[model samples]
Target: MKKILLLSACLSIIPGTTLAQNTTAGTIELDMPGHFQRQSVSFDYVRRDVMIPMRDGVKLHTVILVPKDARNAPILMTRTPYNADHMTSFASSGDMSSVLEGYDNMTDVIADGGYIRVVQDVRGKYRSEGRYVMNRPFRGPLNGTQVDHATDTWDTIEWLVHNTPESNGKVGIIGISYDGFTALTALFHPHPALKVSVPMNPMVDGWIGDDWFHNGAFREENLPYIYDQDATPKNDEKWWSNHYDAYDLYLNAVSAGALGKSRGMEQIGFFRQITAHLAYDSWWQNQAMDKLLVKEGLTVPTLLVHSLWDQEDSYGAVATWYALENVPTSARNLSIVIGPWNHGGERVEASKLGDIKFRADTGYYFRKKILEPFLAHYLKDSTISLPARVSEFRTGENIWETASKLPAPDCASECKALHLEPGHGLGFTIPGVDAGAAQYTSDPDHPVPYVPRPVLTKGVTGSPWKYWLVTDQRDVASRPDVLTFTSEILTKPLTIEGEPLVHLTASTTGTDGDFVVKLIDVFPDQVSAQPEMGGYQLMVSADILRGRYRKSFEHPEAIPANTPQLYKIALPFTNHTFLPGHKIMVQIQSSWFPLYDRNPQSYVDNIFFAPKAAYKPATISVDIRNSWIDLHTK
Candidate 1:
């Protein structure tokens, strides 16, 4: 009976009086319903809850918020897996900002622009009726089903433009993360009323670089998400950690698969898919949104928003931009805005990340200057001009740059090379003397923590993982198992506008291992402006790759023990400058524990099922003579 009540509470079953018997009256009375109908309240906007019918006769839960004086206003919509009711209800007052503070409403932009805001629960989520698939593949080779997110979005937009009498018949879709993925799908066969799309930090390709995996390494920290999100449609289930420190918890769990099994994740469909397709098989390839978008062609003006320090989906926005760069339609219709922010940070406060400060409220500026104008121009017929095809925030210089000054993606070919030379040094020219190798012992038993000790689970809101990308690198640089290569203080500013490629010829005593390379900017010893940040080691770009997948991401081959081989790790996109008096440094290590699963140094057929005994110590050596980094300069 207790379990039944708990389940009832979780499902939000209405409460009232239980069935009763009146023996004396010799008559029966029905259960009385709750008194919810008597409560009345007023809001600033007219809120309407409707279940819009899809092509397949499925009704998706949607909430529309229209301003009291709305007249022919454009509709700005976001279709989300996250519940629409919780996202749309923040206050009972007449202020739009108060009603939409938590979700990625871009409140000021919507409130001031007088746009009708619509939030909907995607099919199979919340109150929507259907089966839910994680990052549901398009209706093609991967998906044999007739209806997908694209079709659902089309049906929703069609309903909005026709049913909403106040709408001007122009619509724009905007969202972040999973919601962003849905927004990107709307561009597949865009409706005539769909005018523009803003996919902010979207999850494009899970196999290549996105939320699921990077290169060939799985993001084990995200396992909790799979449990919470896929356990049920309403997502009422929760994942609890036995240990407070994530490092200890993951270490004790032995392997991610074992941990997941202990948590009953084997029942989740998405978890099963993740385990079944560990490699970048056709399952992952066919669903890549970036590739799908290119194949379908860009039909609407799309603006991609990228965050320089985005902790999640960092590669999606930039990767999508590159994939669409050469497409004829993209040249004029695609625009990108890159800023210094965490995942979806552009929608909230963004003046600073971690210990670093940008000296201004960058989020407010972006919404007012970039997002608002872009929406108004395309959706409201405003004369405000949009930024260039590429608009990125230069970090150290702390200013925005448009396409006029943006350099090519691989301009490092023209700039001088930054080589990893002997005696822990980085120089413009290669070292003439032979430096044998830089060696370090990698022990899976005591792997390097991605962040400082006492690391908490990242699934919780406001966790340090949100800004862990910008955390000081000094913590790991001091460890003996890590290698640090530094350059002399810069006499002039060093600017880089694109990706940084790490090239290394390395060998390990075991057949498998992992390599993590970080490009960082070392602040000066003394700073006049901020004393706390003096000598801070800030990571500019970094990434990791599993050694077994060196030749190809889809295939796994064990490394020849003690034999030197070449490894190229491509870091994420960045637009930053190492100012004068600052130093440029690179750090290399084998593991980024708890964040990514430990690479059982020894060879294994499948890492997900690797045994505890398979994880052993290995000696990793980097041949300085053959190793160097190629930096794309401005």
Candidate 2:
């Protein structure tokens, strides 16, 4: 009792504290109030937390930050499944830079330009009240409800323009990854106030080439993402790993479906959906954002940002640009900026990714020179004009190039074919002799590791998944199962500005398989500038295709055993130049394991549920005479 009284007296004497006392049966309880307010320092911005009501009566949690001197300021909003509160409170300090540190906030423009900054939790995320659906489909066949991201965005924009008196009634939407998908949705039925949209590294088509799957081969690394994202409403469920090495964990599990069951991921709705639809079906085709955008057309001024080394969603931005470019409206309203960065790397200092260096802070340059100016022109009516339709940061050359057009018509018309010759050589001319085959046995038990092993699970701290795209390919080149073909040292620079097509005529001993193709840039044997990068084999573009989907993505069929079949794969866009003293290389292999799920040599109804018996060794033979890579050159 005396100790409590003494503590209360001490707290009461403190200049900035107060004490309250309550007595029960001669025992006194004292409560000392701690200062909850900042002292001496004043925040330059004001933050308001509100529940913005959607069209369907669901209120989304939103955080709005307005500059103190703001008047008739434009609004910038990002709709995200990621928690709004956590993203808004980036730092303990009141400084705007300290608060909006990452993602698509554009800290410099928001803090200095005096624009109203807003971030909101999508339906059923964080404090938002509603049931969550992974990548909620538009309000039609997929979704029976009237509300979707498009409608929700419409409602939010309508409320923001009308309710927030500090704004000039102009709005822009920007986000990366999944949030980027929401930004794209805003273009469907944009509010009167919504003017511009910037979707960086958006998830355009999960089935064809993004996040969940690349072509028909499932990206096994994303299984944990589904577990974490869809297992609970708050995304509080963490993906737990029982093994130190992901290689053994995935291999030992036998199949992705079995792995999910072992990890208790069956409850996750997305996992269930993924397992159910092993082949590209109406469900996935209908949800493809790029195709949807094509139907909707470009309704607003949109800027698509792509990263050359983006480990995730590398196909989305470029694919979306390709889909909408031919549309008359899009030609005027759509522009794209490609950079040498990783997924969502534009938000951070991006001078380098893994062993590759761009010779400049590419992220900063994109934000300030291209992104900021574009946003300013639309939102703030700034006098600065927008850049060309396409702004690309060319690697190897280490310079930014602008063009009024892309998928350069001349580049495609003058495309060059690099042929795979006998004795593992790469050249532009067709081989004189027909090499029988480059044969290798692909064993599921010893599937080639995507990266050097001690392969840690993705999403863990220090995991190399983020920059794996830029990691050296030399590690896998030595594997016997992987066929390596290299060209002589280049005396002149070779620039490829568009998608490189892989034409393969290969045969598998078994009924099913996967082909992994890589276009690599082999550095000089001795790099004078960076010793660590000497002889480094950097993958310029790569993708995998399941043999079953070679004929059609929607249909699956067994490969005729030991029969050569033509497989054409379109590698992702590469605006890279192979400089003098460097060599061009091509690597072909089966099973980039743990990154992509192991393809059971024997065909099954569903690969996800393939049993242990399905795993087998299969001999793969590539016909060097027929195999060639068509490059879209500048």
Question: What TM-score goes with each of the models?
Answer: 0.93, 0.95
lDDT, candidate 1, 372-469, per-residue tens = 98999999867888767777789999998778333455644565578888899998888766777999999999999988988877866556898899
TM-score of 2: 0.95
Model 2 spans with C-alpha error above 4 angstroms: 1-41, 408-411
lDDT of 2 at 340: 89
lDDT, candidate 2, equals 0.89
Query: How close to the true structure is residue 470 of candidate 1, measured as C-alpha lDDT?
Result: 90
RMSD to native for every prediction? 7.0, 3.2
Worst 10 residues of 1 by lDDT: 15-24
- Which numbered prediction scores highest in TM-score against the true structure? 2
Q: Residue 546 in candidate 2 has what lDDT?
A: 93
What clash count goes with each model?
1, 0
| Residue-level lDDT tens digits of model 2 in 382-485 | 79988778999899999999987677422356899999988899999988765667999999999999888989777777789988988899889999999999
